[model samples]
Each structure stands twice: as structure tokens, then as C-alpha cells.
Target: MNAAQLRAAARARAQRWLRDRGYLVERLTPDELRYMTSWSDAPIPAGQPVPQRDDPRLVALRRRYDELDWPVTAHSRWSDRSFVDFARFRGDSLYIWHYRESPRVSALKYFMFLRYVEERDHKGWLDALGEDGAFGCWTFEFPGRRPVSRDLLDSVNELTFLDRHLQLSGWDGLRALDIGAGYGRLAHRAAQALPGLRDWCCADAVAESTYLCEHYLQYRGVVPPARVVELPDVPSLAPGAFDLAVNAHVFSECPREAVRWWAEQLARLGVNWLFVVPNEADGFFTHEADGSRRDYREVLEQGGYRLVVDEPAFADPAVRELLRVHDRHCLFERDRP
Candidate 1:
């Protein structure tokens, strides 16, 4: 097929896939497509506004997460209410604020993560992870509640390309670390591919995610050698620990100071490669000075990291419903020593 034909085919396929999944897909201007809130009980609108029953998965999640008795709180288990919960709670308002503007994306992302968590638990990954594991998100305590079909697909594609790119670049034995290891989904996938990693740690500033990882490891019956740490002013990681440090779509929402602090921490961690996945042309945080968005590259570089790999975006089946339209690209090795 010619370029135009190919593009047309992809668009058709995308629209069909979205419709099959109950999204109302429409082509707006050539550059953008707007997915408004659907009145339908769909966690996200399949199209613009309409009425439908709430999704069963969403109902289950709300029943579980919204309950005051579900689990941890300031008054609940101290260990349960760890730094992870604190951070998430702190971010909850911010996230909610953003959700008003992009409820569909937020809701879908949350739903997919929960789904993945539930699936992993059903697979016994959670039991294998042991008692140390706990859930990370403020919305739901399980990964299964979050919908991530497009995100995962996009992640897999990005990883596939990254593997090839790194292979061509003589990148081998590259030890790595992941901050904000939400439910350990992305890190788990990366571990499956990057065999050369000598030392790798999946970390989150929050204890909840670490706890969840432990649970997930149990469910999967896999013993993890690395443990999660409290995200410090500087991470208490071993010096020269990894060749790569990655945060997928993590830094974008983080405060500027936090981003700078983490970048410096990564530099101290001795990683030569830094990878970040964010929306291609936009970020979560906004600026009042010029009503502009944060620049990923600029902030990281200012904090002492360099971009080594910048690749175009690809669609992920998990998030295809949410992000198939925009330029949601992934960047690898964004920060280099």
C-alpha cells in the first residue's frame, strides 16, 4: 500500500478496534481526535457523550477502592500507609485536577492497571511476591483495575524497537533501574527482554507499589533480589549500580524540583542510559508564565542527563483506546552520563 493508503488503513483499523471495544471513534482535524467523556457507564467514553451502564470492572474497583474499610489509611496499618500512599494521596488532588480535563485517559489508565494486576494475581504472581507486596495507586489497590491495553501494546512496540536500537548501538550487559515501578508491569516486561542487565532494581517512591510488587512476585512465584526504597532526596541506591535508569511517563507529572532531584539521583546512581516515556508533544504539568508545557528534554538535561534515543510513537493495544490518536511516543536513553 502507498503511504496514504497505509495511513488510511491504519486509521480504519484503529477506528474499528476502538468501536469493537465500545469507544466512539471519530476523526476530527487531520492532526487530532478528541475523545470526550461518554455518559455511558464506560470507564471512558467509547465516543463523545452518551449513556451506558458503568463497566463491571469499574464497579468492582470502586467497590474495593472507595470503601473506607478496603485497607490502608492514615489510621490503618502503618506499613500499609507508607511513603507510596503518602505520595499517591498527595498527588491524588493533582491527579484529580488533571482528570477533570482528561478524565478518559486517567480513568482508562487506572482501569487497565487494575486489570493487569488482577490477571497477574490470578496467575499467582501476587502470592509469590509475598507479604511485602501492596497496591500503589490511590484509586485502587490492585493492578487489575487499571485499563492498559493500549499502553502495554505501545510499550511492547517501543521496547521491540528499543531492543533493536540498543543492539545496533552495542548496548549489552546494561544494568538498569526503574523508578515508579507501578505494579511492576513495565519493569517486568523489560526484564523479560534485557538479559544483559546484571543488576536491576524496580523502585517506587511509594511503598505501596513495592508492596504490590512483592505480592505480584508471590503470584508469579518469582523471587526478586532487589527491594523497593523510599524515594529520597537522593536514592539510597548503590553507587555505579546501573547503566540505565528509566521512568515511563513518570517524570512528566512530578514536580519540577522532584524531577531535578531524581535526575541528579540517577546521575549519582551511575546510570549511563535514561529512558522516559511521555506524551509526544505535551506533558501533564502546565506553566503559568507562558501557559506552556514542561519540556522533558530540557528539564532532564538541566538536571544532568542527556537524550540518547528519541523514537517516534507507536500504538499500544492496551492504551490504543485512549492514546491511538495523539503522538504518544517513548524515549529511551534520554539521560546519559
Candidate 2:
């Protein structure tokens, strides 16, 4: 058979195999196929081992976390097993990239995202918040910039997007609450980027996350403006204390009940705006520990929040597809009583 005939035969066989396995095969253009396969050649980094010496602070934090009687939903994937290494909490544990993502690919995504920001960063926030590989985070140096990480790029992208919607630049005395604030990544960035930000409170149901957030914000020396609110203390926050609430890649990791609980808190606190970055591209869904997905949008709405904006994390569809980053940035406003 000619080469073309042989290729056809192989395609047929592959399709047959997929069908037998209860999979649907879709045809793709060469460019589309190239985009999908481009990451295959990217190199994966070696895994770093957890340090032997445990910090006494982390141990105390863990004790505090263990003492609390958390609901089952709050004890999902993050608390189920040792997902984070306290010693290297900022590395791959919080905002993980090394395990399921390629370093080179992630760098490309960050570079593209930087380009996107450069066009809109009239205030030079990106330059102000340039990243260093502090706390063992993975870093890549993009062109004309210092070392950058997913934590930095994602935080800046989110901030810029939020600014566009909420005019955050002009909002003086803005108080923000971060739910599932892992390692205080966004909290640190938001504090630096928005000088008018009165306070940025980092809260998390996971004890390790709270511990790291508390340590990281102080380690970065933004503790006055940015503070970690332990799970127990979150309820005590007075109504209307915060103007905005952000939950990035957080609700998706939580169970439905946990999402509902958080939504209720936001409603009770009278937070006017909510920002969520779900893992899904098109829907608001929760990722359960048992590898199941449940819709959490209704839970938020039940708590009197309504979706105001839903946009792709990467505005350019081509860039989003090429980078394989399809997260959606969702903003919602709480309905007044």
C-alpha cells in the first residue's frame, strides 16, 4: 500500500480501538493537533524531597488544625492526605505545577501571559511584582524580566483581570478576603499591586494552607496589610469588613458542602464582590476527592451571589489552547438584602 493508504488504515484501526473502549474520536486540523501535541517534548523537572527537619511553627499549626472539628466537606483532598510538604510548602505543594505540568510549557504560558499583561499594565504592576524563587518555588526567567513563577504570573493575571472588572485601582481602602488562600500567593501580590488595598485577609480550611499563608505573608513582610485568618477566626469577621472576596482554583477543589459554607459566609459578611477561578473552563464545578465533579454554582446562588463576569483566564483563545490553560475567571456580586 502507498503511504497515504497505510496512514488511512492506521487511523481506522485507532478509531476502532477507541470505539471499542467507549471513546469518541474527533478529527482535528494539523494546526490543532500540533497545538495539542506540542507539550510532549517539554522536559519535566525532578521532584524535590521533603526536608527531614520539621519546623516547630508548622507542628504547632498542625496541632491547631487537628484540634478543630472540621466538617467532612472541609476535610477533602487537601486534608485527606499529605498533599503538602510543610518544609517546601511554596514549591510544588501550593499552586502545584511540577507534577502535572511541564516547566518549559508553563514558562511559555507565563511569557505569553506577560505579553498580555504588558499591553494592559498601564500602572507597571507586573514590574513591581516580579517574582523570585523564594520559598523553593519553581521559577523561569522570561525575556526582559527577572525570574517568574506560576504564582507570580497567575496572581498578576488575576489582579489585572479583577482590576478591569472592578476598577480596583481606584478603590481606595479596599478590604479583600481570600478563601482557600494557598500559601498566600494572591494575597501577597494583591497587597503589593494595590496600594489602596486596606487589608487582604487570607483564609483556608486546610490547616497546612493556613500555616503556610501565615508564614509566607510575614516572610514576605506584607503582614500588616496582608494577614492570615485561621479557619476558626474567619467566622468572627464583621459584616462588610471586606469589599471583595476571591477564591482561585479553590471551590473546584472543595466538596459541594464546603462551597456552600463559604458562599454563606460571604453572604453573611456582605462582601459585595466575589472572584472565583474554577478548574473548569465552561462551568462552575467542584472536584471531589473521589474523582467526581459536582456543580457548585447553585450553592453560591443560594447564598445570594450572582455571576457578573465569566471570562477565560487567558483572553486569547489561541494562547489558551496552545498553553492548555483553560481556567475561567468568574466574578459574582452578592444580592443586597
Candidate 3:
């Protein structure tokens, strides 16, 4: 089935599952629907997107998130549930940042996020700098209750640009290095996408994430011991190790100085293509509070890399919703600069 069909099928299944569990499903209006669309669907909302304190629903959701550790299955994906879960994992320390202080638009946001996850079929985040103060201290959790890798692999194909580049530029035959490959979602999908890709490495600074990847690989029974790396050897690693390097959610959450260092290392890796991901508006917080969001244009420019093409946001419905909630990933490539 096509992306739209797959999305509809997944939504139907999810809605049915939610209904069976006694959750009400509300049909979204056009405006509400738009909000759940990809970040590129609409222009970035004007200043201070945070809901007002007087807003009862927003206030209630925020209060619940702040006070209670709610069940992940109970709340909507977009609802305060995500924020609460995130806050639980990350701690309330980020609340000190005024922009992140806003109550999450839980219900709407969760719908978008889950859809994106389903569509994209993977949750990609950058590897932290092995520092406690980075990336909100959110632990990587893979809901690997079942074999969902195929579902995610199909979802990533919605990006015409990425698919095209892989086919046209011979990325199909290369080895892949997924930096900060949270839960091996992207790495798994990449493997599924390109049959000729013989070797794949899912590297992250966290041992927990690597463990999850190993588990996933074991479950799939592809590689006896899949390349799940947990080390700080990006800088001095063997040269030309992988043909493609994907840094999802890595540049933004890592320390600013570290981002530059990683960039240089990636450059030296001599990879044919590099994918640097960051969220749309709330990358390092809701409003650039931590300055984690790297300027892709600047980073590439300074690294002396040429931009082949850029995908503003994903077009897959499910992928788009994911963008709304967690990230708005864009792809950049440089070949033989």
C-alpha cells in the first residue's frame, strides 16, 4: 500500500485499539487538523506559542503532568501525556526555561506525534555527549512489545527526497553510521530500505540505547551481533568507515561546542551524505532557550560542505505528525565538495 493508505490503516487500527480500551475519539476540524499536520504545513506560529494560564484545559493538563505520573497507554499521544512522560524522563529542570514552561497541548500534539511515529516507523534522536546535563536526560525507551521494524521501515519511504537521493546517488550500496541512533529505529529502517547495504552501525553514547538495539537486532535475527556501538570514539574512529552518516536529534541536544566537534569528525569520516536533524521551533526548548538547535546552513557552510538539496519536512501523514510532536528533521548532503 501507499503511504496514505498505510497511514489510514494504522490510524484505523490505533483508533480501534483506543476505542476498545474505552478512549473517546474526536474528529479534528480543519484548523485542528492543520495543527496536527507537518510543521511545514503552516508557517511557524507567531511569538509565545505557549497557552495562557487562564486556559482551563491547558492549565489542567499542565497540572496533571507536573503532579502525576500518568500511564503511557491512558492518555492521547499528543496530550499532556507526552510532556508528562518526557518530563518524568527529563526531570522538571527544563521548566526553568520560560519557553519550555508552557503547558503541552497534550491531546492535539500526541495525535500528531504518534501518527508521525507510525508513519516514519522509527523514533530517531541524537546520541548525547555522555554528559548528564545534555538532552534533558531522557532515557531511550523502545516500545518493542512486538516486531514493528517493518512498519517503521515502510514509513520512512514517504520522503521522496531521501528515497530519491539514496537511489540516484548510490546510497543503496553503502554502509550506514547512525549517530545517536535512539532505539535503532532509523538504522533498522535504513537496513530495510537498501538491500545492498551490507553493514550498519547504530552508535550512541548511552549503553541503554545500544542494549535496546541489540535486543531489536536479536529479535529480528539478522546479524548475530549487530553493530550497536556505545562509545566516545567518533572523533578518532577509523577513517571512511561508513558511506552515509545520520545524526538525528544529535546536533541540537548536545553541547554547542560538541556539535562543532562532531561536525568536523563527520566531515573527516568522508561519508558521501550526512543527515543532521533538529526540531522545527522547540528544538532545544520551545524557544531556543538552550541554543541546542544548530544552524544547519552554517554548520555545513563552515565545514566546507555543499548542500545538494533540502527537505523542509516530511510529507507522509504519519511522518508529519511525528514532526509536529518531537522533531522537524531536514536532510543535507555533500558529495566530493
Give the candidate number with the greatest lDDT. Answer: 2
What RMSD does model 1 have?
A: 15.5
Best by TM-score: 2
What tens digits encode model 3's per-residue C-alpha lDDT throughout 1-337?
A: 9999999999999999999999968777776564344221223234413222344544443344345332211222122223322212222221111111112353334334334444443323111111122212212223432222212322353223455555522444567777766555555545544556667787754433444455455544546224665444455577788777777655554444444555676778877677655545332321123432345457555665666554545555554554343344455565463
Candidate 1 similarity to native, TM-score:
0.49
Greater-TM-score candidate between 2 and 3: 2
- TM-score sort, best first: 2, 1, 3
Q: Candidates' lDDT values, in order?
A: 0.46, 0.77, 0.46
lDDT of 2 by residue, 55-118 (tens): 6766776677777765523555565545565555556553655322434555666677668767
Instruction: Write down the lDDT that model 2 would get.
Output: 0.77
**Alpha-carbon deviation at 260 in model 3, angstroms:** 1.4
Candidate 1 lowest-lDDT run of ten: 70-79
Per-residue lDDT of 120 in model 2: 71
By lDDT: ranked, best first: 2, 3, 1
Worst 10 residues of 2 by lDDT: 39-48
User: What is the RMSD, in Å, between candidate 3 and the native fold over all Cα?
Assistant: 17.7
